[model samples]
Target chain A: MLTGAETEVVLLSFQVAGWSVLVSVVPGILLGWLFARWHNPARALLQGLVMLPLVLPPVVTGYVLLWLLGRSGPLGSAWHSVTGGHIAYTTAACVIAAAIVGFPLMVEGIRLSVLGVDRRLEDVSRSLGRGRGATFLRVTLPLSLPGVVAGAVLSFARALGEFGATIVIAGNIEGQTRTIPVAVYTLLNAPGGEPGVMRLAGVSVAIALVALLVAFWLGARQRRRVSA
Target chain B: MIEMRTRHSVRGFTLDVHFESAGPVLGIFGASGSGKTTLLHCVAGLLKPRDARISVNTRMVCNRPGGTWVPPERRKCALVTQEPLLFPHLSTRGNLAYASGAKDALESDSGWKIVDVLRLKPLLDRNTASLSGGEKQRVALGRALLSKPEMLLLDEPTSSLDAELARDVLSLLLQVKLELKVPMLFVTHKAGELMALADDCVVLESGKVISQGAPVNVLSKPRAIGVANLVGVDNLLRLEVLRHDEAGGVTLLAMGADVALAAPLCASAPGKTVSVGLYADEVMLCLENPAGISARNALACDVTRISEMGHEVLVELKIGLQSLRARLTPSAAHELGLAQGTHVVALIKTSAIHMLG
Candidate 1:
């Protein structure tokens, strides 16, 4: 039977993307809400920092990651101290590197949505005897969930395509850190390149379309419900 | 009871309003940016005012100098702003239940569920998005009621509605007051709204409560001159000297039409243009120019503009040099078919003209 290497690569891509998206949501929402509600002196600076990975060339971002988590960096050493030098060249590193690149997408989407939310609604909620936390949870958060969903999908797509950063930070290893993009890159550099590239490209396209459709469907449903 | 004495400076506007309300329904009347809603917010514990003192049913919710300020949720004070602002995410029933009093919030026997008191069981599952303005207000009212607030602070609850819708909302408010027996601090500038719902009136101008009393007396008296003007008083004219009557009442005349003015009017020289405001309610509309009538003041006039204001009509009359407004039943307007340049009579007694400084 012919090997289904494309399926394996696509599955690994989804795994990394899923982990990246899931890990970043709580922080993304928190920061988005903060940026929306407050007028801090550092808002511009903080926003710039969030978008840095997006602006930096993915290869540059990847190299920076390699330098920061290459066994001797402060975070790398602490992680190594606990996990016995297993921080880099792992699926976990791929997820983390992809998440860092996707953080800006998550933050900006949720931030714009949060800003668009009607704050008067929250005040009315307070007048209706809802406390601050309860009002945010029941009214504010639900109202902004559509943006969160959109952000999550974009983050997942970006994470799935993260090649340069993932390779530099995690060092592609078969069936572990080698996501679809990295596997395709590796294959294209080898003798039987076209077949692997074509196969992985098809898998990538399918996965991206499915994820986007599902994300938009969920977001639209939630928004329609909110409006309804 | 709804009592507030506060001074809160917000941006450039300074809100300094002090008033007390124990009436089943109380209204704060003011123009736009006149600080009525700020006063309401202070009483609701939504805004903490400097040097403020607030009490609701013997419970002091705020004492600013003493650093005692109950948070809004803890205060059990509900507010309905210009918009009904019913929770869009919730159904009508869900919104009402959202504010229902916790067991800890109740000290007495008033623990109303969504269905029993508001009669909202039928609307429980119905989405609030589709409710009409009046229905949404009713739901908002129900939500506020179910909260078991000691006092309700309503800021222009019906201001968003048309006359018919406003009447419906006001009647519901009256019903809520009657059924719940809870005091309400309602704030609005609409004269009709205040008259419909409020037993006591607190009139504010430039963030100060200049007049506060029973609605009719405060509204009709000379001390409440500014409020009367703000309420669109029809007449504020010059008084001319007329022959003093044998009864020792100085017969001061006003307008091209003769009407006696009560004497010893503040800053009154016989020739002084003493501004006496006459509310439209004080004016009488007659179908004919009768030869003899018990009404002391009668003047033949032509109709200017007949504005249909709800069930009633506001007939503006051009009598000699003055224009007078008369609030008449639509039936009267329909009976006369009063329109532009139609002959009519405005018989306003001297005693009916409320004098002011």
Candidate 2:
């Protein structure tokens, strides 16, 4: 029963969040593993740097991304020279902003899960004639599946509701970068935009409820398997 | 041959020892914090020692001078830790196949052989989390065997199991040795398991090799009395198998000129000397031989030494040329006037003597 504009906003929101999670999952899992397994003095520093976006304001993060990717910036000038296109104020910018804001949640979920895995399991695997790499793929990764799944779902939900950063970097272009949250913000500011706001807010709650249910189901299943 | 001479020190606990073994199974016997597990870890290449030279079958796995080191996977020494760490993500069959690198090949002949020997066919498809402690240990052993390891290093593998389950696992290990013919290093604090599984033994105490020799020699030697007392088997006598009376279901053995004992049927031939184990707690000391007693063997012995150990008093007796240890309560010792140079009768039940192999 969504209007044409509402339907466009919904589809754009999914597109932006889907791209954001898809691009960040691999790097997020890698950072989680590095934090879990690597032993070094700088490990705390690296973890703090990755978690900075979780505490910093979304608008500030967006400004930093815009400064780095704007046409006048070094990377933006180099890209413009090669391809003659701008990166800021685009759909790509919205994906980048959402991914940056959601990355900490993803990495944190996976890191805690990875840390929960027993290190003695890896030693047993190695004694079974498997190398370190093979053991990671066979034992470590499989045991940490619940965390990975939870991380992906959380990052996806965070990206779907992103607002301040998306508007600051990507702007509220209709049918292009106007994600559901950005559209809802724009609608509430205009005269008599209350009904549209109610619809979009309802959709947001539905998505978040589904994501949370999925995470709970996965975590419970993992615990049952462990204690079976 | 497995030979290791190493020194490792960390956090006030150090392991410094040297020994060589050419037997099928070597026993590393010690108390809980005696560095036995650390020595096994070094032999398995799980941990590198500070100064060391480790060779297995003439191939140097770790050498300080040559700067050669082999990782655990390359060392081909399968370590079975005290906790049976089966992969919880996989089923019992999957864990065995994981070791063989055959994704779904449990139907293979070698796989079935291991499954059959371990009596694990009924548990093949079950998830490891569903298996009991003893069942999980069987699966762990099966997994290690399937990997075709050059040697097996067991770190108190049966310590977590109850006495019955521990005996079951130890019997299975003996079967594995018979079938697989693989060199193994069994580390344990139990004297019974050490006697059952190992031919040559090394005793470690506080990160040093206190005794190294045949199991009987090391366990019964006067210098290793502390080790023997720690293991709870204080009296280890060398008795020759004199004859067998199959009708009585017993084998008669000679302790000396006048002292003889009957044991449960063993496979030794006549005149073959065998070491018989007796726990100090099992021996009953009486000032006068009691008629109508259930115990069959009563030998006259002269007490050589007496020592107080908490509530119990350990009395060493000289039976012919051999020594026997008997534990008595302090009150009983005082009432019986048990002291060195006293004459006493050492009565032992026929079933209490365990044949050490």
Candidate 3:
């Protein structure tokens, strides 16, 4: 009943989500800041590309990642030799897939928060002898924290639900690679697995509800602060 | 010696403003859409004109051709716009502290402290958005002062407030001018308020300087929109010169009205004509056409139009071959029963007459 298999999958979900957010946070914040402040040559193109993960089928995205990271594939072969390891069927592949999908959501949230801050306040800061860096640290970042938090939380939730990409590349190894969605699919596929289905469904619902509530709380706080 | 030279083209309008002056308080007097705010933006280094050079006390904020430029924060000048723009996230006290820098041990003595300066100690914990317009502007003023800026750019700071609130904001500004050595440029179209506050004025018209000088000099020009419409210059009378005294002073006959100047007229001769200006406030309205009064040049007239303007009512009278404007209290008008087509006497003292070109 208390098998290590279920625990490992749950633990694996956390690991993958953690790694995905860690690798993407910097690029996400920078891209967000860029989108909020500067207009570049590829701004529209970049915006479109960032949203592609949401619009495209998850299976197609997972296949593309598989092709890009397969042992015989161009980057995969080079990465394998350099790191003395294979990327396919590994936990790292799950993180890469999750991050690839979750990046845009995080960036968009941070960008919206930054855009909401008053430019006039920045001017006021400049007149007060604070340099651009100091002003960003003191005023801009503080104001944008709620949005950043919301974005990160949303990204975590997306990573938690990631299924197609993980199965295609990382494979459904029971104790190593199988996460919540993969486990749910397997339970539904087996005969007389109604008890397992009911148990896993309960856990999934709890996690989704908590993540949604947290996102809602953050959004409400941001609205009150910004609108005021 | 501060100067700004710029050319910024925006669709139908082109802002080409250039001026250099050393007045303690200079009012950028103009009508709406006259490029007053644009000029202030350029000065504040918020918007760099296409090709321009702006210098304030040897600090070169912009030079376009050679690519010399400084950002707004480095400009060390604060702009107080029609809206206070206090940070909504901060309290009134926090908003004041939002721009406060350079806190030394002797902070309370430098005339800018969170507690002592704004008188916002009570509203310290209250959200800035909840405060009154005057309170917010006061907070904004306090915020700007805490920055210890070299010059203050106030763009219609009290325009958003009611009369009582505007008066309160103005009183605070007056206090700043007297206390600190900070120079200020206030943009407004109200000449009466400018008269009550500004030390000097630059009259701008459709993005050009029609006149710039001492407040009295610039406000007295006959062709000046500054004096004509805004100040309600009562007797902007155009007529022939009647006499010239041996001393520098000369006298002119304006609209069949005798006017004498303390200074020599531009071209004082028998037939030489010039315009003379006198404020309606200066031209007293009298009930009886009393003779031998200390007031010179009393004209028997009829009150034509009476309209309310601020605290005073402007009484337009068709006086001595010309219609003239005169300001009187509503109580005074009520007491006198000032109405249309009522015969009355207008009094203009020789001292109150402003010789104009």
Candidate 4:
């Protein structure tokens, strides 16, 4: 039922959210396990830094990303010196914005799940002549899969809804970085955009509901595993 | 062979345990919070000690002064804890296969023997999450064995189980120890398990070795205050089986040269010497040779020693050359006017005698 432009916007949103989740998942799992298992004093600092995006204002976070990736900024200058390409106000910048805003949610979900895994199981694995890495892959990772999946889905949903960060860093370029939320905002600004707004809003709600249902299912599975 | 001389202190509880056992299974016996589990963890390489010199099969695992320390996975001691923390995501077969990472090897002699010995073939394809507690433990044991460990470290592996289940698991462990001939470090609070499983034992009391030797020898004496009851044998009577009345369901046992008692029917043949375990509380002391009582055995004895325990008195009785201990309420002792050198009759029920092979 959607027009070609609306379909493109919808596909772009999925692409950006998918990429954002993909970029955050591996690092999120590693960070989550580290936070759950490591007891070093610096762990608190690392945890706080990881959680900063979750508590910080999204607009402020976007502004910081903008400065970091802007043409004159140090990183952006380095990027220009190497690849000779501007990252800010691009589709790549939109993905970065979505990833940054959604990373904390992903990490938090995975961390809690990793924490829920019994350490005795790891000890048993080690005693069975399995090294730390192998034990993690064979036992810890599989056991914490529910949490990992839930975290990824939640992060994808968060990435889909990301607005302020995308607006500031990616600049809502039509047909390029204009995701569902950005498209809705743009349509709202136009004189006769109420119908378009309702359509996109409904789609957004549908995606969020699906993500939430998936997360709930995964969480229930995790609880069953634990009880078992 | 297992050698561990370690000292680790945590929150003011200093654990200083030292022992060396070359026996097939060395039982570490202790109550809760007595550092038994901690000691096992040190041997398993799960806990780093403040200082340690540990060796397994003559190979040095950890030596603080020598600066040689082998990590857990390489320790070659497969630890099976109380709870079978099997990988919930894996099937029983998968868990077994995960240990050695060889499905074909498990189908081979050593691994197949483990599966067969643990009776896990039927449950192999079932998910670990679906197994019963005893079944889970069996799978855990099977998984540990699949690694072909040099030794097995069992930390109260059956403590969480009920008596029947615990016995079942213990019997399986016994089978493993006998069939595989794998040396084991069996840590337990159950006195019966320690006696049945270990050739040698080290009794820990508050992180210190109170006694270390054969379970029979070490447990015979009250190693520490309030330990005899915990040992499950307050009085051990070395009795010679004279005869068995199968029709009557009773066995006549001779203590030393003269003292005799009737015990419940046992499986031992005549003229065989067996150790009989009698709990102190079960031995009743009477002021006179009481008749008309259904109790089967009553022997006249001289009270050799009277030691006061919590709310009760442990009366050490000497009947001829054999010694017996009876726990009497303080009021009974007062009523009977009991003291060292007093003559009294020790009454015991025929079924109360437990034959210890």
> Ten-residue segment with the worst summed lDDT in candidate 3 chain B?
B256-265
In candidate 3, the residue pairs with backbone N, CA or C atoms under 3 Å apart (3 or more residues apart, or in different chains) clash, namely A126-B73
lDDT of 3 at B159: 89
Question: Residue A121 deviation, candidate 3, in Å?
Answer: 2.4
Q: Rate the local accuracy (lDDT) of all candidates.
A: 0.76, 0.86, 0.76, 0.87
Which runs in model 1 stand beyond 4 Å of their true positions? Answer: A213-228, B48-53, B58-60, B63-66, B100-121, B221-314, B318-342, B345-357
- lDDT per residue as tens, model 3, B1-357: 467788887777788878887767888887788888888888888776778988877678899977788887788788788888886666666666665463441156674443455575676678777788888888788777877787888988988998789878887788788876678888887655566567778777787878888665576565565434853444555657767655644454655454333324456566876656676777788788887787656778888888997889988888556678898888999998888998888887766776655
True contacts recovered per prediction: 0.60, 0.69, 0.56, 0.88
Ranking of all candidate structures by their DockQ, best first: 4, 2, 3, 1
Worst 10 residues of 3 chain A by lDDT: A1-10
- True contact recovery of candidate 2: 0.69
Pairs clashing within candidate 2: none
Which of the two candidates, 3 or 4, achieves a greater lDDT against the reference? 4
Q: Give lDDT for model 4.
A: 0.87
TM-score of 4: 0.84
DockQ of each: 0.41, 0.51, 0.42, 0.66
**Predicted model with the maximum lDDT:** 4
Clashing pairs in 1: none
The stretch of ten residues in a row with the least summed lDDT in candidate 2 chain B is: B99-108
The reply for model 4, stretches above 4 Å from the true place, is B231-258, B262-275, B278-357
lDDT of 2 at A27: 94
Docking class of 4: medium
Q: Write the per-residue lDDT of candidate 2 for residues A1-228, one digit (tens) a residue.
A: 789999999998999999999999999988999999999989999999999989999988888877888889787788899999988888988899999999998999889788878888888788777888888889988998998899889989999999878888899899879999999999999999999999999999999999989988877777775565
